[model samples]
Target: MRRTTNRSAHRAGRAGRVRRTATASGAALALALTAAACGDGDTTGPASEGEFSGQTVTVAGVWTGTEQENFQKVLDAFSEKTGAKTDFLSTGDNVSTVIGSKIQGGDAPEVVMVPQVGVLNQFADNGWLTPLSSDVEQDASQNFANVWKDYGTVDGEYYGLYFKAAHKSLVWYSPDAFAQAGVEAPDSYAAMMETAGTISDSGLPAFSVAGQDGWTLTDWFENVYLSQAGPEKYDELAEHNLPWTDRSVVDALTTLGELFAEDDLLADGAAGALRTDFPTSVQKVFGPEPQAGMVYEGDFVGALVTNDFGRTLGEDADFFPFPAVDGGEAPVVSGGDAAVVLKDGKNQEAAMALMKFLASPEAAAVWAEAGGYLSPNKELDLSSYGDDLTRQTAESLVEAGDTVRFDMSDQAPAAFGGTAGKGEWKILQDFLRDPSDPEATAAELEKAAAAAFKG
Candidate 1:
């Protein structure tokens, strides 16, 4: 729905984005946590008395509730550094349409925090995005991996920078629950299934499956596909260079069905799971009387467990990397929101300044210390994270930078990937409901994908 005219319908029930880590080896990088400034008046040191004395910058994004509050902390840092008045406008879930209408009315914000790469592509295609300045580009190159930069590029021109990252390849489980089952985290998918089976035999269902939220299904498929088929096929499928009906698609779906088809492995059987949304699924696993021992999703689940359930990560609950499919490196599927400037903005200088600041580790550390956040910036020290589990999780993401892939469905056309009750979301929901035939499921996915890509 990137270019949709029906803003209201699109806004009603859009799926929440579940959205990170470090370098190649499992070890943390040795880069200095902070770079020294050349002189006392160095602009990099911090905001001078009034760097941009009389400017204002407005940023729009789909973040609401706590996410919005955390993002505001980042903006507040930017304002304090540059002496600019910063404002945030929550676009709800329909950012594309809301921003599009604002642009049409000649009132677009100075910057937009795009939640999907698909929508960023849409905005870039519409000629609404301003090509970022060389300084901002250099700042991004220094802070982020080439993969993050690639997501913001359109036709060889960089237009944005990923400000926040989400690692979607985590499996959160109760430490006590794992001990009760007498099992540890497994490295490969086969071993994971065995672990789940052992846990289930110990009187608790193994996994909390959030079937009611179609996006969760897409994340599950993406991690398995990326692990089994590898990154090359992932890129091809994401771009539609490889059709959805390809053997790889069937293989991935079949692998996922190994979990979906097992009623006993799920917290609530298949029917109850189909009625369970994301938050409820988390509750079933982490609440006082848990029904399930584990749940699989992004690192954001850490925040929910801590804030909502008052559980401390690494003690009451913790997460492991989504297991490998065929015994190689387990794949890391990441998601993020990028800050892109508007070409028609009233204060281009201020917006670009904000963009440059957002690309710096200093800005990222502001939110990182606040909890429930991860950064793709290679230089940000893992210590900036508030907890040990978060530090280790962020380290894993950084370690996998060379092989990491963004959320697959997010890289597709919004009509196919982001929308609810249609295209990939609905089709995956159907597959979850009845995963008997992987081949048939792949065919249906291909049909929807082809039509969406064609449009």
Candidate 2:
């Protein structure tokens, strides 16, 4: 449910893609609120006084192209306003490796942008993150209270600040195409399926599901699970208390497999999904001759489509919340990037000051304008968004009183997340190619989940 825009799809092209060669065994941490011990209480070698006064803070993350351009504008503005010199170390990929190397070398950035929530906890556990409760206290409600008080906290301390959050569980479609096919916005999963089938019958593909990165499929499963099981079970599963073979998990995967089985539902046999790259697969969705009726992606997909197809969200695209399923409560799946102060940094006060500033409504507004990311600060007026689609998305956040955090795949233990993507996606792909043995596939996934959780 993280904001996996089309930009994430381009991660494969990151210049310094750090491929994790070592595979470990453990229950992948889920994006859930669980109590755990804090780090070793290591201060980054006694916070230096006025260390940041004349020093240029180096920021690192895997953002480039237009995304970088947008981020730089914000950084430039921050420097102009605060007179805090800043240097952005933009990298194409290998974000973890780059950050890890910096930390190991005792030269990590003052503030690091971590996209995956699961890794944040791991970093904190390793004494690699500095607590930020003081910053949080400066401005409380402006931050997404739950996310800050829960996921960003460990052992009663805050170590991260939410800058921007993305709404997932969004189904984007060509309004023109939907109208041409005589469809209405679906209010339920059943209605959505019926509409999809009808759209396909009208000679258009139903959905564009990119399974190459396997994370997209994870989003589908998480959304369905959230709708079917509600927040409690979702949180339990994320915390590793529930097994993947549970009825709810199986039910969600089964639902996705059924969608995949539908004729003309996904582009060219969804099994081909395993081979298509993330960017290419997304391009197919927003192509000139759009192949699918709808695409389930995060807010970032709009950027990807715009960058690749020169299509704007409102002109060529619009989105609907993924329809409610199993008569469950309605909630949106939201994800965003958080700035974690590394425990190894020498400028804790300066870094924390920057974080506090970032949490301010003013800074959030600037981020919205610069990066197209929804500000976590509720006090920030979104009236200036201008674009109808963006405004609608922002409104959805206000309306979503209970947001399911990012998908467990990204928030859970890395092993489980990876297995869920690689293992679960393969199972889904097989079922799509031929809906011959859903039970067997379900059993296999259940076993895989057990193995992952057992570790």
Candidate 3:
């Protein structure tokens, strides 16, 4: 819930990330058909020893613990099949800083899992990354969505391949609470407002909005703006190409006020939301005598519910698409970690081999089974997932197609997007505390964006 807590809960999600392109003359698209002709699927079973034999490549990433253990299975398979050794280094929270320091120290790992598209682009621009090899480019293009492909590409060269993604436009609700309140989930923004009204009238709070976590509030702003203002406008705003005070933004914020404006609709009202963490936000909704009817956040919310809170998905807690505003379709705000190869790595072939391995369905399946992982690979076998609902969640993302957009805040500058207790985070918190004045809030947003973007 970065949007969530610091442990397993906080490793919430990522968007498009990728690697260098195969050719300055070729598009990532041109190789897709060729990759399909070669029958692209999870083929990482084993490999014969050759030029890369006995080579040891290192990978640095933010995941650890069971997540690390699960990923080790993939690494071990790579080692077994290719006769190449690979070691993983956890990059901690400051991956950009750590990678930058390593680059300066001339000791960069062969490959690094970059979490933010914005930061990845920064690396590519700085010429700190090696462009993708032809084989890696074709594999990514064939398997990943064009949006993801684009995220990895800069100046016509691919550098990051998006391996995983998280869908943020979801509202998790308690079926029991909805039944008790006698209100079904809403299919449209208007309907959701009405549903909340119904729940409030039935003597229950409607939403456990996590105002304590500014990222959650930012996601709240992102989804509403994306659906209401449309992707083009959303993109313009995300890149600071448009001002926050624009009518589309004002309209989205005004629309958000419909729910936030009502004190009774939120769990313990604005005061409670300000005090509630992400885990507690969900806990309050599904716990004994849930004070609220629902919670809105990324897919990790479901993971926490099933893993941490010990709740069943379909029976206890289920989510619906964050309904659209103004007759638009729901927007898919994708998130995840992206892996890239370093330009100065010692074992180039082994590093490329690891990226190629990760792009496969077999690699994705390994993490899927280990739980708390979701992939955007169309070739992945849904049956390999542990549960039906988890599979369904993955399927829902794949089905989103062109409607998918990376998390807007994630794509913005860190000061504007990533920093907590600053920029959009603080402004949005101010918003939940006072939705009646979106005009004032939008002005504050514009001021922050100008300073952050200009700085």
Candidate 4:
């Protein structure tokens, strides 16, 4: 439940004929995304970023603090090596509003890191984004899989390139706690329950579930549904093409219920879970002689453990992909920020230069070494990562390979996917509070989704 938003907005006008012409096409593009192992895609890297000496590039993103600081190193490298002036701006939480207002006022950054593909596509549809340049297209083809390249595609043209990627279906845990309690990561849902019971018996709550952030509850259900019910149903539920009350949806909820059933199973019980924010949920397990042994979240948890908790990764904390569901293969649920070029920018050459660098492995390695980022570029040297733990985490994402999907809720409409106090967020919070009536929960979820989707 790290901060998330749909931020859907109407982009007013289209620059006449902003679409780039396609020469040769790759495989037919489908919105479903999955990647193979390392060097999985048609891995290619450009010779070098273009020289944009004596010019400036304006880049905007939602990152701040460490993320922003680390990215500055990349931009600084580009500027120093190529003599291009670069400025980076963090557009707080209301990125859509900020960018939209800028667009209306005839002032927008040359490049923007869009967090949601669905929202980016809306911007693309309005012609505010320039389609990928030919060289950029070639770079994307060389460095990324078709899935990564296509995530940025709108109407057969690519508009965004994924610069930062995250593997969301992961459970962060304390290796020390697990070993001390003789608890092991489970392989299946049943094994998870048995393991939870064992860990709880050791006097620590087995799971530090975060109920305060309802999106975590959504992830809890999504990972199960994607693995157990498969992608088609997962997509349908996300788009609301399938009703929330569907048996498949209930099955996902019911499977998740196993973890929520007993008060002792949760850290500080349901009441605390309902109040504990995400970072605190992590602290509960990795904090001093903790109350819990595990907390499920995304890959960013490693950075949180090391940077926020003043702990080491491999020794103090580690993570395992969400276990298999009902003996089915585990699905890799991912979320990432993609960079797009604004069609209306004044510095197109400098902007393209930066995009070229981002699509390459060398620059990605810099961010990788800086520790708060993950890149979709398979060309990245695993050894460049600051620690083996992070390298392993990245490897796992690629290893799960073909069994990948963007977070379902993240791809849905804003009101349905990202809004608080309604839709999936609000409804899933209720589910965590009371798993006894999933059918009712499903009904309420559908009600919210139907209304929001209409909006």
Against the true structure, what is each candidate's TM-score? 0.89, 0.83, 0.88, 0.86
Please provide, for model 2 over 236-325, each residue's C-alpha lDDT reduced to its tens digit, 9 standing for 90 to 100: 677667866678877776777778776577766566655666676667667887777788887777777776788877777778888888
Best by lDDT: 1
Query: Candidate 3 at 451: error in angstroms?
Result: 1.9
Q: Once model 3 is optimally superposed onto the true structure by TM-score, how far is the C-alpha of residue 172 displaced, in angstroms?
A: 0.5
Root-mean-square deviation (CA) per prediction: 8.7, 11.1, 8.2, 9.5
Ranking by lDDT: 1, 3, 4, 2
The list of candidate 2 runs beyond 4 A from truth reads 1-52, 419-421, 425-427, 434-439, 453-455
lDDT for model 2 comes to 0.63
Model 3: lDDT to the true structure: 0.75
Worst 10 residues of 4 by lDDT: 28-37
Q: What lDDT score goes with residue 89 in model 4?
A: 62
- Span of 10 residues, lowest total lDDT, candidate 2: 28-37
The digit string of per-residue lDDT tens for model 3 on 33-59 reads 100001111122223563456666677
Candidate 4, residue 108: lDDT:
80
lDDT of 1 by residue, 296-363 (tens): 99998988898899998888998889999976558889999998999987988878878877777777
Query: Which residue ranges in model 4 land beyond 4 Å of their true spot?
Result: 1-50
Candidate 4 per-residue lDDT, tens place, 250-321, comes to: 888888876787889899888789998888899898776587988999988877787777788877788777
lDDT of each: 0.80, 0.63, 0.75, 0.72
What are the clash counts of all predictions, listed in order?
10, 13, 18, 1
